[model samples]
Target: MLQLAWGLCLTALLGWDSAVLAAKFRRPAAVFPLPLLCAAALLVYAGALPGFLRAGVWGGVGALGALAVWGALRLGRESVRQLTESSGLMLFLGGAALLWVVLFCLQPMFFQWDEFTAWGLAPKMVVQNGCLYPAQPGNLKASFTYPATSMVTVLFQPFARWSEWGCMAALDTLAMACLAAAAALPNKRRMAGIAVFAAGFVLPYFFADTPAGSYAAQYANAMADLPLFLLFGGSLCLYYALGGQGRAYWLTVLPLMLLTLTKDICFAYGLMAVFLIGLDLWWAGDAPARKRFLPAVAKALPLAVAVVAAFVSWGRYTAAVTPLQETAASVGSEGLSYGAVLLGGVRQLLGIGREEKFAVLMSLMFRAFFTRRVCLLGGGAAAVGCITLAAAAAGCGAETGAARRRVVTAYLGLAFCFAALYLFHLILYYYNFGESEALALKGYDRYLTPYYQAWMLVMLALLGQGAGSRRGAGALCAVSLAVLGIFAGRGVPAAGFWSDASSRYTLRQDVQTKAAALNPALQPDDRVLVISQGDDATRWYYYRYELTGTVADGFSGRYTEVGDTSQREKGDFMNLVSPDNEYLYAGDCTVCTPETLMAYMQETGCDYLLLDRSDGYLQQAFSPYFAGGLQDSMPATLYRFAGCDAAVPFTVAAQESGVAG
Candidate 1:
């Protein structure tokens, strides 16, 4: 709770700084997005400072404090008065924040695969070590080049103990801030704002009917996907709401920089935003083409530069800190270089002859856009209807009609951008992934969902923006409520989503509990080998995360060549194993007999063995090696191996009891 409070307080301070800074240049269209803007600024600071100084977390805190002090001095009585007058926006944000707090309390654990491997792990490392993951002395489990924006944003304070819930709450706060910016729209109608917020909030749930089920689940996890899309969509919505004026270039630059730094692939989104911004600028006035071109270039130049600078700086930093081979290994597969695979994919596209993979990808993407992604399709349809009604009501001569037309143009622009982004992913996967995975389009929805969600939010913003009349606002509200009802019926209920024990959340909770129990008996530098029968690499990742301070390694007990000659006939079956698995063989494999197991332990330098689940074969084969047999424990049994001989049961028990005591 203290961590959560600190996070919220820091978020408020940074948000105030952002608002005050923007107010110095031009009055913001609305103040609700200040937190998100500040978050972007924080990312820029965190990403940049590390290059020049190794001050780590203190450097970030110092930046936050400096910004806050500056904002406090600049904050005038008039600014406070303006903030007070915006009571409706304050209440909406407060309510959303409260709900986020409640959601974090209900489930503060990460259940997703990538959460432990990358998103969740990276931030925890930063918080613990006060430096980037690469700066730490260990083999990098997560990709070193993965953007640290999300990780940096979660660092609410320096020297504070890391809390998973706190990090999650911090992330949720950013998302809420982004969505709440919709209230700052020029449309003063209360119903229209509510409709927009409702649509954006429930947009992720719309994919529940598709392969990416349960937005609540996604929300609970600490993956970068949810926050990345929210920032992307929210930034565009705010831009359009502000009428894409020349003065709002700062808004475009900050968010674009932050978005680009959130994920490596997100640079593409930044470029897409730049294209849209340029388009908006071109269509701004009734000036000649020659006159508009220069102005558009001048306005869009800063945004493009910011995105490129951010991407290049982070790339250079990672290259300096990480080995080229490691980065290549993390990104591509089958020993292919990133560039080679990309070029090969392009060549395949150019010289395609009835490409079955291309056909499948197109078909899947079509279904995803038009049919499976009901929320996007429905939201797009509703946006068009609302814009049409607004245009018809206001007539073509009115400013409102022109704005609605621009909205239509923007929607079409976003569709084109989404297509381009999707094509890029398809091409990358075509070369990087295996034939089966590429054909099946594994993780197809996960890859595209963020972009789709972002596009949906933009569409919803347009719908709200065009809700000029009472009747139009009413229709928009009706559509939003209907969509919400469909989400509730088909998706996981928002209220009970966290409490679903049948989900991966429960399994992770169990892993965490077991790790907590075992961590006490183990030393910080202990080398622990985890063995969980019937489990995969994911379980080891959980233990690796939970065991913190200890070196944890493990095998995926799911499959092994063992006594199967047919499987052995397959050349190098180990090549098929996931790189995530620390050890290649299962506990019960033919090569895992007593003497071989001891040799394996020595080879890996593992001093402790944790049987997360033991089979009959494991018990019979290894029990004789332990002098006092396996130390029985809930969820797992611990075996302490000291120089190829098991330690006495009593000594281990005493240490465990002492730690528990």
Candidate 2:
């Protein structure tokens, strides 16, 4: 089964990439994936392509780091004087490489909870069905839990390989590597700027890799989201990297279509990227950009499938997770801050905020989307970066045939989009989060928007060509280093994660650790169910989580769905634990085990039921049928619920009057 899984994933991945490669090789192409071959090679060298394909967070970091080091080594030796002149640049590269190594080395240590909830769970479903299929509860996810993207999202995983969250890291890394390579190859002066500033690669890096803090890779590891980030970011870089023509131009559009298909977030950035690409084309010449349209369209055809997939995925998530249960108020109420409000316009354009937060509510009134953490460079630095880059481009305008006006327009368009994405979030407080008072949920920063990096890199590229001086780049390398140093200095010590008081006790433990605890010894045919709240049980593949290294061929499952009407079907519900199964590890959610849950379980003939509600859902306000029966007990204690908690307590009350246990 494992070998077959590898065969499937390898075929799909190779077919997709190699087709493009074969096409590019057919002619003298622009920006070939050649530079990335080494990274791909390293991944192949590490282990079975499927293992990394299944769970390649660490693998990607290692691959990317190794490839980058190799790229630098190919730079040909620099004279001692030249090396000395660029000591700061060399040191920056070395430090970043070191960080990458550390990131890979400690990758296992930092993997977290949500990874299981979002990343790990989806792939498991894909592996089970042996293809992209609807995930049902108690196996992988609730019917509505996975968005429409689940089909391909699942397909992207090595088919027949029962793993979760693994493929997400791999796909995201592909996009990230492409984006970084594009950035590195750009003719901008800030090429070194983005490199040294370190913020340019933030999201793409962390999305495929991992990060610190509660929401660190929490944002990146998400299946659909990080891919969306890469699509948008990569498309933007592709426009600049493509220089308005050649095979690279075609490659740029594929990511664009992908951006649109990934998530609602892409609609905004996709527009920016496409528009920027158009501007690049227009500036390149009157007929040349238009002449390449066929090739671009042809190259982008496969990616268009992503659009169909995204729509299908969106329909699923909307049908399940947010249906009527998630109203404008509930979503809008998720976070309300002034930063979100004032930056409402910014948010809207960047696809970050809701209607309530948009400066003009009607602009995005019809659509509702929850935004993720978008990192970009910040403030005075952002503005100065743009101006300097503009100056550099302007200086070259006469010497080179590139259109300064078009580039500036693209930059400004990017800026406006970001500003809009930010402001939209600020206004969301009043219109969405119900913030009648001053909003303070911290909505309008670079971390929540992409423009920051766009702005930062553009500015840096400009500065590099204009003058490689540190202060000329704003706040000398030392100061910038000090700031990053401070952040790095805090390192693992400050990397702890936090959760709401309700689940704080249960969720605070390292996610992997918590998942490990739930792993039990079992047979090849054994099956398990994890009923968790807030991303608790992901990486629990009997192999990874249990790590008992014992033999087991059991397929695993999860509960919860993405959108509305997205819950387990009777078929999957019945298959929760195969007939020969022995154990189950559960997470918490008052939503589960409700009256409806009891019916589902009894119908499935479940022998044992475990409820490990993180924190305590014990005192939770329940329906009359529930509260009157079930109740809370010791902290972190596992409860056995047969019939119902309500029934047990009710039986106890009746027992006092002579009822049976």
Candidate 3:
């Protein structure tokens, strides 16, 4: 209920025009609430709102609700009649809402490694500390370079207080809904729009290669990529709308700003998108089109540029704080020429079958789609592609030479830019690393997702424009529905049909339970150091709340010769276990000694030490100072410092507050 209210409030505050535009078409546009909700959270985090405003985001929610109501009332009788005319659109909206609610209830809290360390840790910290900075210096590996807009927000913060993962999942629902709304924008074909919307929900699962399916894990995790789909895709649609007659140009501002705020790569993406918009404007040729385009760009570019500048400044800040050697680990030192890089990428692409069969198979599926199929899936995709291309060709023939030149220039320019960017990303990966090794990496596939998504939106937009005939729209609607049905059938069983939380898939509940058990003994400001297998679980350690900070794995420690980097002359070392990050340990030396370890601990100011069973060898070495143990089904042990109290009561209420993730 609060989620719905917050969505409504957000819609009022930032997306009133978007809601009105959707109403103008009598379409089910539910996306207006999401970005506005995100914007509200971001404002509070940036300290733009009054201090008193932070107590509950709901106050802003109420005000926004009132504003939305007022806006609706002003729309008058004609608009009301227009909205009520679409009974079919209403049914689609109702069904989507019900399915999303069911999915939200069935999903578990985040258990993904990326979720814990990369993105989730920051929000968890903000919610606990009531501020954004890391409480412990050792906790910075969670990538301080990451943008905070979607990280710590009201949705996940005070409102969904009990479930950290649940907050992430709710945001996912909103983002998915927005993407659907973008696909269903302004055109009158209600069923086609809903099909487009359903495709957004199912496509990610179809693309996911895991046996457990995308929904069982990926979609629910609090990551920026999913939201990127909505913001970037919507920006393109609005860019297209600049050529049309509407007030959409005004609505494009916040989503574009949010896009820049959401991720580092967005800075480059936004710049390129702006460049494309300008190129398209020049080709639009019509003086009136140019007039509309210029003013929209004038209003949007300032905010977009400011966001890009702020993101770059934050990145520079993170770079300055990191050491030279550690910085090398993040990016490559040897630069490859463009020719060599491109050649390497092509060679690697052809040789994909040698490693990662999934990539090869998926590539073939996509290839089959373009060339024009094995079965319904590929055939439907090919048919859709053919229809869009044929329509584009016919439109090209219908235009005068000057108009045709303009259309061709814009399409070719966009195609070239996307290809260049995608190649640049792939080549960097292949050049820095070996062929098969790069293929094995996840970054290659991750980049492809956005690349395909952008193209998919473009194709869908083109198809919508050309399909003025009822027969064409009905064909698209049928193919889209078939695609949706196929994915829904496959995804449900793979996701465990909503029977279990999927918490056990990653074994994170025990981590939460252990943290809860240790919370009462420590103050809100007490710092705890977790000695585990690696830094992957650091965010998991910090998930719910019990400690001021957690010291996990990092890259800045003394370099040692371990693991196989036989290709390189000198291998990099594992970061030694140092609390303060002052001293370096090259595998052996003071680590095994009791006095040296205790002195290091004291220097680091860790109030408590939590040890994973994987670190049993280190636990044996520190057995002389063993204070006590934690209660758990898992192999986790806790020991207090020598001068600390011997006994502490275990509190399970916090752990029990929310039933598993």
**Whose TM-score is greatest here?**
1
TM-scores of the models, in the given order? Answer: 0.80, 0.51, 0.70
Clashes of 1: 0
Number of colliding residue pairs in each model:
0, 81, 3
> What is every candidate's alpha-carbon RMSD to the true fold?
5.7, 12.9, 8.4
Local error of candidate 1 at 629, Å? 3.3
For residues 56-104, write the lDDT of model 1, one tens digit per residue.
Answer: 3455556667866776677655445444444324534564467556655
Candidate 2 per-residue C-alpha lDDT over 1-661 given as tens digits, one digit per residue, 9 for 90 to 100: 3533432343233223322332333321113332232233333222322233334423533444453344345432322222223322233333323333333333322144433344454445445543222222333333223322333333334345443333433443344343343333222333343443354444333212124443344322444544554456545554554555554455554455445544444555666665555544554444566685665555444445444554454445444543344322122444444355445545555666444434343333222122232222324334335344544443343223344454455566666766566544444534554443324443333234344444444433333323334333343243234324533553222232121222332433443343344334222233333333333234233223322222112112333332322433322111232112224332221233344444444444433232223223323423233323333432111222345444452111111112123
- Would you list the rank order by lDDT, best first? 1, 3, 2
When summed lDDT is taken over every stretch of 10 residues in candidate 2, the lowest stretch is 650-659
Rank ordering of all candidates by TM-score, starting from the highest: 1, 3, 2
Better of 1 and 3 by TM-score: 1
lDDT (C-alpha) at residue 547 in model 2: 25
Give one digit per residue, the lDDT tens place, for model 3 in 39-76: 45555534522233244355445545565666578764
lDDT of 1 at 569: 26
Collision pairs in model 1: none
Clashing pairs in 3: 108-661, 109-661, 560-573
